[model samples]
Target chain A: METKDIYREIINEHNLHPSHHGEISNPTYEMDGVNPSCGDKIKLQFKVDDSGIIEDAVFSGSGCAVSQASCDIMLDLVIGKSREESERITEAFMRMIKGEASDEELEILEEAEALADIAHMPARVKCAVLGWRTMEKIFKENRQ
Target chain B: MTNIFKNDFEILHDDKYIYFDNAATTQRPKQVINAVSEFYRTINSNPLRGLYKWSVKSTAAYENARSKVAEFIGAEDSSEIIFTRNSTESINLIAHSWGLSNIKEGDNITVTILEHHSNLLPWQMVSRVTGASLTFIECSSDGEISDEEILNKIPSNTKLVSAAEISNVLGVRLPIEKISKRAHEVGAVMVVDGAQSAPHKPVDVKALGADFFVFSGHKVMAPMGIGVLYGKLSLLESMPPFLLGGEMIESVSRYDAVFAPVPEKFEAGTVNAAGAVGLAAAIDYVENIGFDIISQREEKLCRLMIEGIKTIPFTKYFGSRIPETHSGIVTFNIEGCHPHDVSSILDTENICIRAGQHCAQPLHEHLGIPASARASMYFYNDESEVERFLEALKKVRSWLGYGN
Candidate 1:
């Protein structure tokens, strides 16, 4: 419940030096993630090859620490995985943040486990979920 | 002895409820609360419906509240006072009933950029239906409002000009009286959103010379579900009823029915009479304290709040830095923190301030910022609360891991 617990040292580090914090050279798919109430907006771009392996991923936008850090950590996890595996990881992260991830799922959630504490923050759930939601949209759109 | 005013409201005694969101809605006093309870307990009958004793007494209570509101706002006739749910509803009644009926193609509906969405959106609807284009008056960066914006924006094609007496977001008072004069000179009706002004200062709609004036009862120490809209007698007569139902009719039939006059015509269905009565009690409480004292106390508190924010090096004020221009509101943002983050940290300290755009997107867009944090005060708040708020605000950047 303490405010300090919510904004950990790691979140600050990730926010300051966000991974893939710029646009992709030529993204196969990209989409916008917006939380209008909080004014957090993000544009997610990814380069997935014909084999469905995500070759590159980058995110660019403005938001609070939780949101920026969430997207950065997320891009770092999903970049080398196949689009199929990326979708699975996105699912587990969503489940983890909602306090529903099993032990096996948390093990796969990777560095995103640092943010599982976001489950306790009711107001911040949206910030933690923005990047994962964006990833889900990209994969869903590609399936079509 | 100076803190005696805090005793009127039970909520102020609780050490945790550091309520600084007075601009959104104010905390009700015990007297206002008891008046509402007494109405439900003793005189719980529909007004203007039956000739039974309870009904007559209820009608008397309701009508008396109307007169109190009329007197409170300095309306010449009680009939000018029409009750609605809140300021939003009151303004909507004006737009739907008056704007729809009167506005025509090629006419212009003038409004300011700083209007709350309640004040801004209705005009947009009216303009859309009538083919009347909207002309927005701009405010200076320091939130200095002048009649020049109106005088320049309002052409001879303008039919009506609506503006807020004080902006809920910027916390700066607008020059409504000067704008009213200009609007009149240009043959336009002036509408004032007095939601922010009435609660902080003594409001005289007639003196302001606005055609339609509105303020919510809840923001002035009354309960919710009640608001006052004071329209010029002639203007109300010209517009049709916004809502049509039983009480607003003179005589009903299976076919066509004759409508009642003016205020009642607009106030359809069973009225919020209990809310009106509670509003009257609130007015009595405000009058007892007097506007002169209320303004002076709030002015001092606002100045202290502005000073405290200034002391924090990274804090950036959104409106006028001069405290005298503020309507007991201080909207600001931290250099390295988003407003939501700032307010979230402050909330952990039990300090309640409004974050986000404060429902004025046009104004926020004009200011070139997505959102800001607001700490609005009322007479119930004091210097100690300001100190507590400043202490919490100072920690926001640090809590978000920004360096001291």
Candidate 2:
């Protein structure tokens, strides 16, 4: 497999200049994502409004382009999404990473479908899912 | 591709790929492979058990392998050598058998930051269990630990000093002889982790004054699941058995048992006789090639790699700048690129390199980085392989969209 298959232009752009790459003020839910195997870490935090809309989502940590870009793109998709909508997208993203999501199911993932190739590269599967897993943990625990 | 010994390894049949993760485990030569199979086909039996012919031959082959290890490392007697699953198990044997019983509260166990987790974590467990303080003897940014550093860190109250002869990540050789001498003066037992050094150079545990020397068979071209631990005869006699079962005991009466002597006492259960035979064959191969020729080739390849990496922009190779100091390992990083990404890019070019903390996270933390990429080499690696690696490494940043 070529490097282009994994590090496409979209990934490079999101990794180089992530929009929601810093912390948010008074986050409602936060979780730390750590890949102990390679030392990639991310602190995922979310700001949710009273009606359960994710107002802001940001992450602060160090990792590779796949991990960093995956987080940035995930936040871009999750922001302005309701708790149920974001949870559906999160499930689709996880399925895509595991190489199990159908095209119709992965439609909600949008740009994150770029990471579908990560399923072939077993080593980076952890990196591609680090942020998503952290977000899943936050949602699973903080459900009202 | 012109490496004279490369043809002996079947894994390198494909010229398009280069293997640079030797510090993790070296590829086994055909000679070692054949010896292991031959042992299984011809002398397959439970060693040191039963009075049958096959059992006798199996016992002799296992004991012969022990003698080969003792001779290879210059141990005074074969009884000093104990076969383990790997260096990690050997080091753990020392920690549980020797460290727990000897080390007490208030005593400090000193080790260098360059130690692999195999050498470090066992001591950490000993400290945690025994109430002993675990201290680190830090190396410089370039992986140098001077005599002054050793003298200052290893005080009179120190009870043990464990260190690796060469750092698996940095590839720089430590002053283990000096450190062992100091440990002796302070009445501390010195344990040398020779997993990296034993494969690359000639080592004399006696001359180094190491009370315990441990190494793995796989890292030296033997099959996995076999390792060697060489301890002083008296020291081995004094420590309790780390594992106890059928082979390690002389007699058992339900609640109480009579443990066997030094080496057998440590070896519990049925041993890996085929793995031992492979290791013995590997030792023969190393001896035939000799360290003089091996060191010269490795140094030449390392210098070529270092000089090539120097020309790459926004790149920094860790450890001493001197090529001779690095046995055959070069760990480096490109600015803004994670080591995991670099390793993936190299994989695209059919090159394999280690991209992690190399089981030495404490050293990575000491170097002020989360992780780094390492390209370690064995004697079979040639200059052509080094050139290919450097060429691929140059494109790593660009492949990740870093501006040239």
Candidate 3:
């Protein structure tokens, strides 16, 4: 029997009261990631400082509870961190969701680590990674 | 098709899962399952290859299945039936083959707002290659297609018109006969995506005057890897081969090649003979009870389903609330819950329904919804399933914490 307990109270709490839910007035970088098959889209908007630190980050769009919560949690993690630190955290979170994270990486992913059980549901892994993948895509494009 | 067909389906007897995703695919009857197994066990040979007994026997089974399909849909000739992978491939074949050759720059391709992406995207590509303009005959908010829109959207430059006989998402039965007549008057060909209609009602391509009709076998009762593209014999003969190689060729040399007749020319490579056999068995199973029984049974279930959905104040039914108009599919959204959450909540009860855009993205955009959940019923489904679905649906909002 498959378990449906993936929607823990923490995920619901984040979905209900998302801190990073709206769009930024003006942003340094913006990109949209969509699970084209399932219709989940998260547009990640970020404002970076001159010191290569992310000043503010927000996501806008509609998606499932998990995706909405994941975006909210993802932006909260990277808001005040340097680009270098945010990249490491996002990498750890992605690894954690994909079931490949080490103890050190899981330690870096505090609230986001709640989705670690999501790796068991292969169909939903994309929902947990939409915001992070969009950030990764924008970083690659900016680097190029 | 029969009232007792639930027993014929192995899943119903062996499992407790309630299947409401019939629009995606139906559970196969024991007959279809056994026919496929019998084909593999007895006539295991590459058809249309060798002149041996096994090859001849397999070839006969494949052609016999074609004949059954042609007869099932009221086609005049068996050769008009071209086996494809699924409805998507069948429509793609028409676009790549017929659309590429006939449509030109400055031509217009007309379709309804309710087409599945399978029916919409191929024409999008055809327009791209041919430089043809595309137009849509908008449906009403309740998903009704009127005659005025048909007359208005299809004009002098309209080269080809395609519409689904029934909308997979909205469950709206389009006036294909009316649209086909307008298309004919304007010297345009009519293509009907019968993916949703063929399985639910009696479909006669000639009576409907469709120049081309496409449907998937899996959606009806057959296995995957089998689809049917029914075209007028003249049109199939006029179009170029969608794929060319192997059995599709009459004779071939290094430099030059000659192609076979209509159906064979379109069907390249070794065909899905076993899948065709399974499809024929599925047709036999559905036809055994006939559309009268199927439609009546499904309509009653749909009415019960709609009535149950109406009890939820948060539920917003996307199409006609009247069950007869739905033709057995119902798509809806709860007030404060995302469709994924609605479906996930239902999944905990082992109730299988479809979620997302249902591959009709343009319709969802027009409806101002990001996605919706769908419960598609079939003749095999009973009234208790609908009651259970309603009971589960009512809990969706509360499960997502909408309850105060």
Candidate 4:
């Protein structure tokens, strides 16, 4: 894939002006994900309501465009999802990043399909999956 | 302009990519590649294990390589050279053998803060296991480690002083001779990590006053899995065997074993005979090119890169501003674009560069940067490549959507 295709308008927009690019106040769950090799770091914050539906999700950190934008886009997709639905979507996003998600899985992934070319760029795969991995870890550790 | 020596390297013959990551590893010349292939085809037997014709030839080739390395590094005796897998294994050998037996509680080990992880971590492990303190010799933001800092930091009870001759990240040369003098006065062994310096310049272990000098073969255009460790004869003889097994032992009974002498005592198991032959060929190739020409070409390329970066806005390079101090490495970052993005953008132009902490996280932490991008040139890299690199680097921010 050409560099332009990977850094498309949507990816650049999300990277430059991410809508959920801040901390959630009084967050119910907070976790930091780090890619040790490249030094990419993300602090994931979430506010899940009493019914286990994620009311709010945001992130703050320093990283490359792919990592930062991937996190912002991921939080946008999972904010209104229930704990179970978010988990399933996180799994699908991971699969999409790896280029293994089926047609139905890709449909469920929404805007995250923009990063499907990450599979061709193996070096940036970790950047594309940093948010989903962190969200998965947050749910796995803080079991409902 | 074309690199006069580029055609000698098969990988660089094609204009596929401009390789500027020589600090990580170098591409082997055809001479070295052919030498390795010749060794494998002619004599593939275990060196020191058999008495047949091919076995003797293999043993001769291995020992000849040892002699070449000793002569190349100006060691007094060939027996002082020990062949290992790489510089990491060589440093680990020192930590495990000499450090475990000699260093004790209340002692301190001094290393420069600019060290690559190979030189730093072994000392940390030694400090932890032996109850010794680990201290660092600090450098300035410009990558200068002053003589006063070295003097004050090495404690009176210091058992060893280890430092890199040239930093892999900053590309600054340390004062190995002065550090060696201080360590000697304090009764400490001076160890120099020559992985960076040996490839770009001439190194004499005796002139540097190093008790132990270690460097990797791959970084110097030799094949991987072969490294040279030069120790003072007296020190190598005194230290115990690092890896215990077949070739290193003179005799092995059910419960008792007498180890071989000097170099062999340290190199256990089957050695990389083909790798040694290839390294010898690489040494010959470097000698043919001569350090005078190598330094001249590298200095010119380094100056071009530093001067070019100055013209580009929002780009700053680490280390001393002087190009001579940087050897051939320039680690920099664009203000608005991340280092990974910069490297990826350069990748679109088929330009190769290094991006990350470079196995020196402590140095990165000290410098207050998370990571950096590095473009390290060798003699084979010409001025045109530097121009190409800088041109691509200038567009990195714009490609990432940062406006002019």
Q: Which has the greatest DockQ?
A: 2
lDDT by residue (A1-144, candidate 2, tens digit) is: 345766865556798899989988789998999998899989998999989999999999999888999999999999999988888998998888788999887888988888887888999989998998899889899878
lDDT of each: 0.88, 0.91, 0.88, 0.91
Per-residue CA lDDT of model 3 for B243-270, tens digit only, reads: 9788998899989999999899998999
**Chain A TM-score, cand. 2:** 0.94
lDDT agreement of model 4 with the native: 0.91
Q: For each candidate, give its TM-score against the true structure.
A: 0.94, 0.98, 0.97, 0.98
- Model 4 CA lDDT for position B122: 94
TM-score of 3: 0.97
How do the residues A1-144 of candidate 4 rate in per-residue lDDT, one tens digit apiece?
576777875457799999999876799999999988778888999999999999998899899898998888888888898999989888888888777899999998888888888888888888888888999999999998
lDDT top scorer: 2
Cα lDDT tens digits for candidate 2, B1-404: 56678888989978988999999999999999999999989989999987999999999999999999999999999999999999999999999999999999999999999999999999999999999998889899999888788998899899999999999999999999899999999999999999999999999998888899999999999999999999999999999998778799989996999999978998899999999999999999999999998899889999999999999998989999899889999999999999999999899888999997899989999999999999998888888889889888889888888778
Model 1, residue B253: displacement in angstroms?
Answer: 2.7
Task: Name the runs in model 1 displaced over 4 angstroms.
Answer: A88-121
- 1 or 4, which is superior by TM-score? 4
Best-to-worst order by TM-score is 4, 2, 3, 1
Put down candidate 1 lDDT per residue, A51-96, tens digits, no spaces: 9888998999888778888899898898888988888898899889
Writing each residue's lDDT as its tens digit, candidate 4 over B140-242 gives 9988889899899997999999999999999999988999999999999999999999999999998899999999999999999999888999999999999
Please report the interface RMSD of model 2 to 1 decimal: 1.1
Query: Candidate 3: misplaced stretches above 4 Å?
Result: A1-4, B1-3
Candidate 1 has an lDDT of 0.88
